[model samples]
Target chain A: MDERAALDLVGGLVGRAGDDAAVVDGTVVTTDMLHESTDFPAGTTRYTAGWRAVGASLSDVAAMGAEATAAVAVYGAPAFDAADLEAFLSGARDVCERVDAEYVGGDLDGHDEFTVASTALGETDDPVTRAGATADDVVCVTGGLGRSAAALRAFDAGDVDRANDLFQFTPRVAAGRALAPYATAMMDSSDGLARSLHQLAAASDCTIDVDEAAVPAVDAVADYATDDADAREMTVFFGEDFELVCTLPDDEIATARDACPVELTVVGDVTGDTAAASSDGAVTVGGDALPDRGFTHGD
Target chain B: MDERAALDLVGGLVGRAGDDAAVVDGTVVTTDMLHESTDFPAGTTRYTAGWRAVGASLSDVAAMGAEATAAVAVYGAPAFDAADLEAFLSGARDVCERVDAEYVGGDLDGHDEFTVASTALGETDDPVTRAGATADDVVCVTGGLGRSAAALRAFDAGDVDRANDLFQFTPRVAAGRALAPYATAMMDSSDGLARSLHQLAAASDCTIDVDEAAVPAVDAVADYATDDADAREMTVFFGEDFELVCTLPDDEIATARDACPVELTVVGDVTGDTAAASSDGAVTVGGDALPDRGFTHGD
Candidate 1:
């Protein structure tokens, strides 16, 4: 079994769990672990490592439509450096401040490789899960995509500064909060846009139709990519954008957009034709099939 | 620097963070990561690995006098196996059920080494921290110790079953809740009694004088050990016994003891002689000093 298949097996055993974080007694809890080899490339700063690790988990809280409260981190490194630890912590604190959450505390250990495990907690009376979308819901995404993907290419090309800028992403905490009450379903586009749609659709037992023209590419993505792959396709296949993807009624979109601190774009529509995308296919982009393509861990 | 020194550097960055989990707005959050190589002995089962990973964090919740609500785990393995993953998840779910908490959800990734990162959440209106003990308080520990210490000896001696049995520990959730209101300070003895005492003293700025006869040794511990050391001293220096240690008033000890579901032993007295323990010495045992000598990661 691949990592995804193994995860699916484990998920089946865990009761009442959804993609992203889990909600228990009005609190949303989530965890993410970043290893130096898999999570950080060369030139990735310790500060960025701290920020990215915490931000990844916090994004799950946003996906749940909850107000983030606090976060704790467990750090494991072979050798401890006073300055490196400080930078990493400062990064986490700054990111927590951005979302008005507390970097409360965590544990530290020694390991053969540097590892960071972060857990974030948030509170919400109503949590928006991936299964809540309806056939008539309109699909909308906060901010744009392909920045992280394009940054990876830039990093490969030795443009460390450009890639670093793209690596630093802002979690859509405010945007998720603004859309939660109206959104029929929601999740973060941490995986590629195509995979995210497939997951949400599978969870809701519905089909999502993507309007190829409607997908907005981040401005810097096109200029930064090393290849000439269409920016929209790049956005669809590349992951780690950290944007909020939500499905709501068409009329509610405006209210959500007005409430959000960032730009909102309508990317697709929720459809009743569930079989259209599941028949030996992944996602529907216009009439073409878009296989679930993105980063696969341990591949 | 070693793990402790490195951890000290990181601890300085976090504000008001205690040794165990941190409490925020009545919610207790803690994270722990277990790398297979460092954490698991050769004969450890996947189920035991899962249980130990989640149980360690839950023990932190118990130390804070909180009722655990939920837990999430992030699993990373080089190549996924369905059976292995199931065993791991089953272990986590079973442990959570034991504590009356739900194993909610978490992230999954792939890596070269098997790693389990678990985050536990609990609720407490008043959290018992390590810094709350005053000079007038009495230091006590729940249950007997040195099982894990003895377990380590057994593992080295090829007694896998004995070691695994000892590794699977129950978090003191009920006992912690029972003692929360009365205890002045609290923490888990995951890092050995000596280290825990030193930490509590440093955090609370009070000295603890351990009575030699008061320390209880598990009957199995003596039989399992290969060396000729004092059983109680072995308990003090060896760690990973998931028991609770707290400080309360000398008179309130009985009330706390009456409230506990487990045996609560008065091991020492919290005193005003802070400088005595802090003057490059750790944990006073009779006239001799018990050095913090438990497992040190990356040592």
Candidate 2:
């Protein structure tokens, strides 16, 4: 099968394959996505590279409303030296500890090219699944969207400082935990807000309608989007924001935000229909009678 | 640096920096080695392929004197179909249940070649470590060695049934647990009997000496050796024997054997000075002069 088909098949299997952490009784660990097709630039900040890996793995656990408890990292690094390897491990450990997780023992090997993989075990008493959203639930974001996208634009324009702040992001573990009890459906916005919402919508068997004006944008993104609507569009479509997006009952929105203490903005509401459309008629979650545009492996 | 130097440096750093799960005051989950460099055939045995992957991982926890609790598998398969992927997962889940470990979660991706990695966790009060051996300790093995090596040879020679029995081997978890308290030092012989003894000896700051005659050898391996000396040599040098070789106080040998109820053999004894040597007159263990002949990645 092609990459997309393989992803769908694997995703479906894992989704149905019980919980992520079976030993913890209430915990579940799911393999959200794994593709060897994304391009990570060489000479990128090593710290950021390490953070990217940890964040990627942790985000999956967070998406399930589970707090990461431990992680096992397996990487295939060719000709890597002691210092580089140490830095990589340190980075992973730092992230794990920051998120209140342990960096467990792992395997290492030499490969022709660099390949990093991790299995994160998480624990939770109540798991907020993507299939639990209901009509009239408020779709909320844990933090600002499109900043990472804007950072990428700045990076492409050689704005290193601006890009570093945005690209080197952390997962919203604390925010996810705070919202887990109240949120009906939860997921991390890795494949941009639009695509993630589309997934949440599909999984919940409902539609999501986002208010363009309500979707929070960073100041830097607004600056970058000045006179470039396409760039803004790309920011909404291509950005991996590394933030939690959850749908909760409209009544619980205030309480959830108060408990979370995060800058959560109500970007949309869940609908009974299976469509995901934007209010301004210029954007779509899954797309307007077309397919959603998100990060595709091997694209 | 050479592979040995690299390994030493990396291993030392990992040992120091990585959390000493074995040393920590908690249940330790360990798994055995599944090296593409040694263990399984390079081709064929699709069903056994996943088993080899999951089995190797689960074996570590099994050898740790702890019951298998949970596992996370990371694999790289090149252009594998959904069916193949499902079969692989099914095989992994089968082994997980066999070991009483839960298949918690994992990661998967495509690569230039097929690679399988797994991390298993288990719980026990305190883990058996390799640094507990002492001088005057009797060296013993839980099960027969050279079976895996024999299986490899048979598979290569198209002896399917014989190879299957040998290659698809089960670990001595019961024996490991039974001998945990009696064992002065313990480690699974993944990198051959000679090398594993050397590791245990070095870790425990003692010396190990194996009698060439007492070291067990499979019939096929014995026949392949052409003579007793050759058989002994193969038993010493050939790797991928996942048997538990432990050193215990001389007085506990009888009790350990009775408790384990396996084909326990007292191969040798630990000494204050270097004495372990192979049938070929080369010092294989204990002596500082012995050459490192165990498996090395990228060799």
Candidate 3:
């Protein structure tokens, strides 16, 4: 079974599985598991790995428009190293502090490979969901895309410093909290812009018409890509930017932009027309279908 | 670094460690990581693995004297099998149902080895910690010991059915909730009675005198052991029974016994005398020092 099908099976048993985080009585909780082979690159430092791993779960909380309170990590490796463990904890603590949250310890065990499972806890009385988008709502994204793609390129080129720096993107918790009151629907763009757009449209039963020119591509994309088309492709499909992709009323866009701490780029608008909708939900950019592909586990 | 030393380092960074569960306001949260090589035997089924792994986290919540609300797990393995995934989810759901908690959902990833990370969330107005044991308090335990030891013995002896059955021991959530009002200091004996006794004594700054004859050993211990001495050794030193070990006021022991659903066995008492206390904290059984040995990770 693939990750999605396995997730569906888990959903069948648990009944509450599709949301980014599970909320119970105003408390939001989410968990993310990452393996060294799949998540970290060849030159990735233990500190970078720790930051990226915990940041993934915190991004889930951000998707729910929740106030991140604390996080705990479970680290498993074949053996324990004193300096490496300290570096990992230092990174985890720094990331939590960056988001105004606490890193409140975790469990450790020995395994064959370096693996991390991080859980983040948050709070929100009015949490956002992917299924709340409506026709005529404006879709927007935070910061720039293709940051992780640029990082991977740098790693492949043996520029470890540039790769590590790019790997340390800030999670959009503050922006999510600021936009929560104005967003009609919201989710994090961890799955890349294309896949995230498809998911939001499908969940809301709408079509998203995105202007390819309006998507914000990071400056690094130009340095890494061969052409403008390649840059757009990389920005739109390569994930791990840790940016928020959300929908808001056209009238509330200016207010949300004012309230948000990060740059808000207007990328698209939602529509109720089924003419453009497909099984994977309609996500059209520059009058063409956007492929439903992004960062997925066990691919 | 060993697991304990690593945990202390984490505690130094987080400033809120050493407790079974971290309490924030009225919310209780805990996490556990287990590896196949360290946690599961050759004949252990995926279903039993799921139950035991999630039960470990729930047992932590129970030790905090909290009401378990929900749990999430991150499952990572070398490959995904449909039947195995379904069985694992079924076991997770069944265990949550047994404790009246929700098995909400989890994340999945492919790793080189089968590993599981589980987190349990709970609610409590007053959580019992391991630092409240006072002199003259009676030390009591719930359920029988050596259950996991006997299960391991059965697994080694080719009794897979008996081993699986024994691995499905219930988490002591209800009994902990019942004993919360009376328990001055409480914890789950996941590290065996010896280590747990030593830990509680150190945390509370006291000494514990245990009656070796009063320790309750399960019937399976005798069935698997060669003689009474071996049975007693297994029961006292082999851990993973998921039973509650608590210190209660001498005057409240009778009422606590009446309130708890499980049979309460009074096997020891707390004392203020430093003559018997050592660096690992004093735990004397029949006038002899109890060795601080139990199940530990990466041992």
Give each prediction's root-mean-square deviation over alpha carbons.
Answer: 1.9, 4.5, 1.8
Over 4 Å off, model 2: A7-39, A146-165, A217-229, A232-235, A239-241, A273-290, A296-299, B2-40, B159-165, B223-234, B273-290
Clashes of each: 0, 14, 0
Judge candidate 1 at residue A232 and give its lDDT: 60
Model 2 lDDT per residue over B1-299, tens place: 44456546546645422221232234454322233533456543545666666666666655667666666665566675777777767667777776676665465556655666666666667677777877788888876778766776677778876776566656566676788778867777766787776677666766666675678776779645557656655677676766777888999877888898578898887766434433333333333344447654555
| Model 1 per-residue lDDT at A262 | 93
What's the lDDT for all of these models? 0.83, 0.65, 0.88
Please give the lDDT score for candidate 3: 0.88
| Model 3: colliding residue pairs | none
**Number of the top TM-score candidate:** 3
Ranking by DockQ: 1, 3, 2
**Candidate 2 TM-score on chain B:** 0.84
TM-score of chain A of 2: 0.85
Q: TM-score (0 to 1) of chain B, per candidate?
A: 0.94, 0.84, 0.97
What lDDT tens digits, residue by residue, belong to model 1 across residues A200-292? 888888888888678877877778655556676568877877998889998788888888889999999886756655564535777577677
Residue A292 in candidate 3, Cα distance off native in Å:
0.7
* Predicted candidate 3 versus true structure: per-residue lDDT over B6-112, tens digit per residue: 77777776777788888887888899888788888989898998899889999999999999999999888777888999888878877887888889888888777
Model 2 per-residue lDDT tens digits across residues A43-67: 3454555556766778777777787
Instruction: Pick out the ten consecutive residues of candidate 2 chain B with the lowest summed lDDT.
Output: B16-25
Q: Report lDDT (Cα) of residue B174, candidate 2.
A: 68
Report the lDDT tens digits of candidate 3 across residue range A67-151.
Answer: 9999989888777788889889888888998999888878888777888899999999999999888889999999999999999
